[model samples]
Target: MEVMKVLHMNGGRGVTGMGDSSYANYSLVQQKVITMTKPITENAITQLYYSTLPKNLVIADLGCSSGPNTLFVVSELIKVVDQLRRKSGHDQSPEYQVFLNDLPGNDFNTIFKSLPSFQKKMRNQLGAGAGPCFFTGVPGSFYGRLFPSKTLHFVHSSYSLQWLSKVPEMVESNKGNIYMAQTSPPSVLRAYHAQFQADFSMFLECRAEELVLGGRMVLTFLGRRSEDPSSKECCYIWELLAIVLNEMVSKGLIEEEKMDFFNIPHYTPSPSEVKSEVQKE
Candidate 1:
C-alpha cells in the first residue's frame, strides 16, 4: 500500500463522546505524549524568544492530527511566548504565524472549525495585549520540505517521527508479521533500520533548511530502551496484532496472502540509532 495515500488517523468526531475509533475520540495516548513533553516544549520556546525575539514568530506543528489536541498545542505555545513577553516587560508581543502541518488526508476542516472559539478563549485569557495570531494548515509529509527557506522560528512534533515514509522494501519475506518481530530475520531488521536512517536524515535536512538561525525544535517519538530491533517494548503490540491476524487466517476468515502483503510503516528506533542519524545530519 502507498502509505502516503492511505495512512491517516480515523477522522471526524465519532459516535458518542470520546468513546469511538475516530482520532478525535481515541487520541488520549497522543495527548498524554504532548503533556509529558510540555516542559521541553516550553523551555525551547523560552530560549527562542530570548535569543531571537522575532517581531513575527513563525511556528509550525508538524504532524498535527485533528481534534482538541491540535489546538491545545497551538494554545500552549502562544501562552508560553505571551507569558515570556510579559515577564520581559516588553511593550509589544510578537505576532504569531502558526502553521499546522499533517498529511493531506488529515481532517483539517475539523480543526479550522474550532478556531473561532479558540481565538475567543485566547482573547478572554490574554486580553488586548496578546499579539495577533494567524493560522494556516500545510498538507504534506514532513519527510520532505514543506516550507520556504529560513521561514520558521520554532517547530514542534510529538509522537510522529516513528512513522516511516514507507514500509521498507526488503521486508517482503517477513511473513506472518506486520512489523519488526522476534522471528523476523536479521536482514529484515537491517532493512527497517536503513529506511529509518534515510528518512530521518532527510527530515533533519529539510528542517535545517526551513528553520532560521538559532531556531529551536522539540521532537518526541517512540523509541526503545535497547538497540535490538525486535525489543518487546517496541514490537510487542504489533506482535499481538499479528497473532490475532494469524488466528483469523487459520480460521479462513482472511486470506493468508493478504496478511503476508501487509506491513505497518512504523519503526521505533533506539536512542543511539536516533542520535547517530541526527549527528549525521
Candidate 2:
C-alpha cells in the first residue's frame, strides 16, 4: 500500500463511544506515552524559555493527531511558560502561536470542533493572566519541510515518526510478512534500517532549517531495545499481525497477491541506530 496516500487514523469518534476503531477512542496508550515522557518534554520547554525568552512564542506539534490528546500538549506548554514567566517577574505572558500539524488525512475537524471548550478551559485555569493563544493546522508529512525557515521555537511529536514516508524499496521479496520478521532474509533488515536512516536524516535536516536559534524539539516514538531489527521487542506485534493476515488469506478473505504486495511502512529503530542518524545529520 502507498502509506502516505492511503494511511490515516480512523478519523472521528466511535459510534455510541464503544467498540469502534476511531482514533479518538483508541488513543489511551498514546496519551499514556505523552504522560510518561512529560518530564523530558517539560525540561526541553523550560530550557527553551530560559535561553530565548521570546515574547512571541511559536510552538509546533508535528503529527498532532486528532483526539483529546490533540490539545493536551498545548495546555502543558502554556502551563510551563506561565509558571516560568511568573517566577521571572515578567509582567507580560508570552503570546503563543501554536501550530498543530498532522497528515492531510487526519480528522482535524474534530480538533477544530473542540477548540471552544479548550479555550474555555484555559480561561478558567489561567484566568486574566493568560496570553492569547492562536492555533492553526498545517497538513503535510514531516519527512519534508512543513514550516518556513527560523519560524518555530519548539517542535514536538509524540507516538509518531515510527511511520516511514513510504515502504522501503527492495522488500518485495518479503513474502508472508507485513514487516521485518525473524524468518526474513538479512537484506530485508538492511532495507528497513536504510529507509529509517534516510527518512530520519531528512526529518532532522528540515527541522534544523525551521527552528530558531536555541530552539528545542522533543520526539517520542516506538523503538526497539535490542539492536536486532527482527527482535521480538520490536517486531513481535507485526509478527502477530502477519499471522492474522495470513489466516485471512487462507480463508480467501483477502487476495494472496495483495497480501504479498503489502508491507507496513513502519520501523522501530534501536537507540544506537537513532544516535547514528542524529550524528550524521
Candidate 3:
C-alpha cells in the first residue's frame, strides 16, 4: 500500500480519440478530489462486503484505466481481501485475479507496460509470504459482458460508466441528427437525455450479467440530485459550450452554421433510479 501510494503521486489515463483510457496519475487537482470523499466510500464497501468474498476471489475492476487512481481502487480490494483473510484465520489467502477492463480502444500498450511494475510493487509490498495476486487486462466495453458467467466475486468501477459508447448516432451533420447538438438552433437537450438513458440502462444490464449472485459492486459516477425533469442545471453545459462555439463563428475561425451540435453524452440518474435497477439485477 505504501508503494501503491508512491506510484499514485505521478495522474488519469488520458481521454482517447478512440477514447483511450490511461493509468491514473495524481495531479494536484485529482489528489484533492481523492482525499475529499473516497475514504468514506471505501469504508462502506469494506464493512459490508469484505467477509463475503470467497477464497481465491476473482475480483475485477471495470473500466480500469492505467493510472494512479486505478491503483488506489485496486489496492483497496487487495487490502480488503487481506483483512478478511486475517479474520478468517487462513494462511492460504485468496489469489487476486484483477481484470482491468475498459473500451477496446483503451491503450492496451500502456496498461501492459506499466502492469509489470505494478505487479513488482505489489510483490514488494505484500512480501513473498503473501498469497499470489495476478493482474490481467480485459479490454472491451463495459456496456457489454467481457468475462465469463459467475466468475467474478466482486466488481468495481468509478467515473467511467458515465461515458457512453460513442457520440450518439443521432448526432451528425447533413445526416439526420440522432443527437441534439449543443449548437442546434432551438434545442436538442431531449435527444441528449434520451441517449444517456439508453447508455446507462445498457451499462446496468451488462454489469448485472457479469457479477455473481450475492456479489457486490461499488460504483461512483457523475450525477445530480435535482428532481425537476427539465432543469437547466443538466443542460447548462450545452449553454456554456454554445457560448464558446458562437465565438468561433464570430471569429470566422470555423463555419458559422456548421458547428456540430454537441453535448456530453451523460446523465445523472436519481438515486432511486440506481436502486431500482440494482433490484432488477
Summarize candidate 3's per-residue lDDT along 152-221 as a digit string, tens digits. Answer: 7777777666555555444335222222333443334444455566667787777677777766676777
Clashing pairs in 2: none
Model 1 scores worst on lDDT over the 10 consecutive residues at: 12-21
Error of 3 at 133 (Å): 1.8
The candidate 3 region of ten consecutive residues with least summed lDDT is: 1-10
Local distance difference test values of all predictions, in order: 0.89, 0.89, 0.59
Q: TM-score for all predictions?
A: 0.96, 0.96, 0.75
Q: What is the lDDT of candidate 1?
A: 0.89
Where is model 1 more than 4 Å wrong at Cα?
Answer: 14-19
* 80-154 per-residue lDDT for model 1 (tens digits): 999899989998989999999998898887788778888889999987788999999999999999999999999
RMSD in Å for all candidates:
1.8, 1.8, 7.4
Question: What is the Å distance of residue 182 in model 3 from its true position?
Answer: 11
Model 3 spans with C-alpha error above 4 angstroms: 1-53, 168-187, 229-238, 279-281
